[model samples]
Target: MHEDTAYPLYNRPWFSVWLDAGGNITMKGILAPAIKPFTSDLLDLFENEKPIGTIDANGMIVADGEQLIFSTWMPPIPSAAFDRLTRSQFNARLGKNTPDQVTISVTEECPNRCIHCALPDTDNRESLSPDAVKDVIDQVIGMGTT
Candidate 1:
């Protein structure tokens, strides 16, 4: 149910996805590149700016007995007729494997009353438990977030 529209799919050049040791799949990436007219309609649907389609293109859930396995998608070739340059581009981008930025809000409340803040509201906000904060910091550090 998470939705962020500040960044649109037409602006990004790449994305990165990975799964944590606890089986928690975290996908943090830039907006997707635009679709060209030459692209397949089926694949174009996957690249749409709408959340439903974009999420489908970026995420997957597999049912395995009692467990729900989750993962993200890599760039898919539209067809064998696709040019060699485009195929090589996909390979190069996918091979540029690195960690994306990890943003964790330890506290929703900021004592300062700054006018430039984007928070919907600053009052009576809930903060994460100390142990939870510690855990998140440790996890992000281990994941190599810069």
Candidate 2:
């Protein structure tokens, strides 16, 4: 029996040992998984405490240090509350002559047990009401360019 027959869904490059139709065990493919080392000097660039030269879709990169950059985009906030917080923060920062981007954590009820999470453990979690959230949005838009 081929190992592929036993685990048809396994598409990884390596294969495991399996028994043949005659009940004899045989090595069907590579016994151990292959370890592909990083081929570029990119890893070394980051290792030396340097900033990334360019960030890919996943943000991995190699670059010179001391480069100042700013980016703003919609963050992962609840659909209902996203616009308000985004606008408010944008306005506040703009008023100070330094517009800062904001990233609001809409849902405090995360399932993961991360050690650094700041959410309160109590069942009685407090969140913004729909009407109040709308008010915040109105105030933000009333301010100015975001």
**What's the count of clashing pairs in each model shown?**
0, 5
Worst lDDT run of 10 residues, candidate 2, spans 1-10
Best by lDDT: 1
The per-residue C-alpha lDDT of model 1 at residue 13 equals 36
Each candidate's lDDT (Cα)? 0.37, 0.34
Off by over 4 Å in 1: 1-100, 120-124
Off by over 4 Å in 2: 1-95, 105-107, 113-117, 120-124
In the range 13-67, model 1's lDDT, one tens digit per residue, is 3643222223222234443234332233323433323322222233443221111
* Prediction RMSDs, each to the true structure: 18.1, 21.0
Which residue pairs come into collision in candidate 2? 1-20, 1-21, 52-63, 53-62, 53-63
